[model samples]
Target: MLNRKFGYVFLLALLASSAAVGAEYKGPLDVPAKVNTKFAQSNRLTAVAKAGNALVAVGPRGHILVSENSGQSWEQVPVPVSSDLVAVRFVNATHGWAVGHDGVVLHTADAGKSWVKQLDGKQAAAVAEKSFKKAVAEGSEQAKKSQDLVTRFVEEGADKPFLDVLFLNEKEGFVVGAFNNAFRTQDGGKTWEPLFWQIDNPQSYHLYALATHAGELYAAGERGLLLHWDRQRQYFSAITSPYQGSFFGLLDTGKELIAYGLRGNVYATADGAKTWRKIDTPAPDSVVGGALLGAHYALVTVGGRILLNKSDGSGFDVIPASSPMQYASVAAASDHSLVAAGARGVRVETIRDQAIQEK
Candidate 1:
């Protein structure tokens, strides 16, 4: 996981040098990911998702661990690629996808038991370069950037990573990542097409998070980059951001929209991105992850602080943790508590009205 005191991509790339950006990437699809039985579950995990009743977490070295009983114990599963997996999503218990470094995407048919490579950076780079070559003839600022990307792909073969993924169902989904990377797979991973050119990202900044509310999809990223999918138009349009800093993650509480990132900056949009109101935060640390607990929402910061806010427009209050340690992601446990994992491994805590049962 990218550990940022203040959120951004390049700094994360530097910290994850061993697994990220490779000049000699052998095309992740060509190189099958290896499984190290000894270190599978022990490696750093980035994200976790609930597959029906089972909880699955993915991380560095292609580590995927599945726990059937609310993270009490875990079992490592075999994955095809060794590229670091950052985000995972499941439309149903039996259908899911995992995306990671090298733009690798994996699909599973049997919950989290096994996975197959669906797309990789090498193929994505080829497709992107093909599209860029056409733009190169137009001779504009975007064209120049496209041409440069083509040259980079020719030399590097698509080593960029997909940081987060969203699957609305078995057939429709989107995967987003660094450097304006986004793709759509409508046929259940049978095929994927690049959607970078369709969005209004003239600067081509990194896209960090994807969220959907009331059938509306929104993407958040660097330098206040925001995109909203126009179902009627069949494309994502860039929306003006309330803040100019990078946004690391986004959430839709079915009542309000929250875009969070650098320096504990967060905003809420009840009427979509048309207008936004900044949520008064309790700390200055970056918001790393979030979870919906009933009518309340929990936001976890980089320094392991938990902030609680109501979905019905209440001010945020800091929920103290047992220990002040870094946490990368947050999920609601089956026991009605919250499960957070990061630098100090997994920690489960009971959140009351304003107090917490530290564990």
Candidate 2:
């Protein structure tokens, strides 16, 4: 599948060429990931998460790395498929999920040491088809549209990739991706139900991120699309978006919610997204990932800059990287160090105490 997300053009080009090589060639979704003991540390990594005391990061070609002593060092782990992994999240030290290209979803119960495939694009399409059929039979108002979607899903095959995965607990979570594709799992990904029709995305915008704050779940995506899950209604309701650019991720600072994305656009809302105020940031690049670092929030840019929230929460200050490079994701280690994964692989940096100035 060709991902329209920024920074994935190279990956799509590589896949296109591979497909032209031979008819017997297997797609990354079905091919097992190759182990590279010597060069695993240098492979491009897209996302990182803290698994208790351990750190897990994933990236293109199904490369997964685990760091035991914070992010000081990393070791590659075996994965089932070679599909590009875009995002990963851990509910606890032992339970975590990773999702990416080819609609791949992988789960690990033993921290990041091992993983098993929970779903793929082919299976996901089948799930959506089944759900759509039921909706049509029940005479749902959106029946006609649902039927069309099923036909598209069947024709698309396994090309749609899940961009992000979120789990509220070990048993409850959601995965959202290109063209408004979404699914929910209540049994720890044992089974997933199609959730497209439950959201207010009639235009089928690609959902790039999912976040929760104060028990409220929100989704953000292309064209400034923002959605809030109405628990009672059991559907995702649209919220007024402050920017017209794609939002790559969200940050929950415990006190407020931040939606950040393209061209350094960042907005915060303290009243459950009912209102939002823009937060000025120095970096002009897209903010790809963020994490709450102790009392401060850290945001990483696609241009390799790290920005930290001021202690007073008034604004953000840029912290220059030792060796600047494109960064895709960042996470806070148990020891309060910062670990970032991206085009140049994984890097660990300990934020200087003075970087986050006190009010």
Candidate 3:
């Protein structure tokens, strides 16, 4: 059985990397992605996001596809690295970032047409080590523990992968990944500072998703780990999690925040994480990704299920897909249709009453 906490691509990549342990090989991090003319028809896309009116989806082998006509057609772009990109986010129409295996981060200034590599696992580990060492020298209370963690990071080398990326705007953003790896960039992707010591994750749980609700930055990950950025304290503080299972994604419904993950567990909070209410879902499959439509919300599951709810986070109903396939992430397009990225590829579907009609 697949682990509900990690995405299918993520787990597969980890296993593949492990199997190649001592082999002298050139990894995805060093190689550039090969351009495929049939990428739109064949690539296994994992996540989708809206870059203004354009829809962008990313997947294995650094495949980044962009569609301007609401997912009607797509064009594969050039990327520097072949690392399997897991998640992508655009602050606006022109600036975006994608993160994936090998802790790779790619930036695009011309929307999704072109991209350049930024921080990767090797650089991330070094940054964390330096930051932690400085903190320890300053005699900060948590510095010693953080230093120890970074020491391990340095020893382990560049095998970690970043699962998600979030940009508050063109200048500020964060990238999070496995083993509590995270970094923040103030001047876009120019430079990044390690956030290992800034987050309160002592167990080093893998962070799967990042979301912002009402000006607060939140991260959700393995074993129900949920954290919100505390500007006053200068670090992320843990929220009281409602479930013990892992959370794969977070959705901000304007009126409430929803955290959904393992075994179809979904919880909503309208009071800023102070308390949570269990929301009933139709299937027990993990809810992997979701998007907020105009007045409704659409959530997709790994079992190829779609859950729709109102903006207030109520009236949950299952919107069956015409051809069910495992989904990783979803985004609302300009035509009000849902663009889903999953095992098969990027799929365009529309919701009519309670059924999703594929386009």
Best by lDDT: 2
What global local distance difference test value does model 3 have? 0.86
Cα RMSD, model 1: 10.2
lDDT of each: 0.79, 0.88, 0.86
Model 1 Cα shift for residue 93 (angstroms): 2.3
Better of 2 and 3 by TM-score: 2
The top-ranked prediction according to TM-score is 2
Clashing pairs in 2: none
Against the correct fold, how does model 2 do in TM-score?
0.92
Tens digit per residue, CA lDDT, model 2, 185-234: 99999999988778898889999999999989999999999999998987
Off by over 4 Å in 1: 1-38, 130-151, 353-359
User: By the TM-score metric, which is better: model 1 or model 2?
Assistant: 2
* TM-score comparison, 1 vs 3, better candidate: 3
- The window of 10 residues in a row where model 1 has the poorest summed lDDT is 350-359
lDDT of 1 by residue, 1-359 (tens): 44565466776767788565575556445555566644665556788777888777888777787778777777888887778888887888878889999889999888798999899888887777666666656654554645554566547866789999998889998999887788898999888877766677877799999999777999989998999999887677989889999999998888889899999998999897889998888879999898887667788988778887844464677887865568778877653567776765556667764443221
How many residue pairs clash in each candidate at the backbone level? 3, 0, 0
Cα lDDT for residue 133, model 3?
A: 76
Candidate 3 lDDT over 120-228, as tens digits, reads 8898888887878787788877767676778888899888899999999988899999989889999988998988888989999999999888888899999999999
Runs off by more than 4 Å, candidate 3: 1-25, 310-312, 353-359
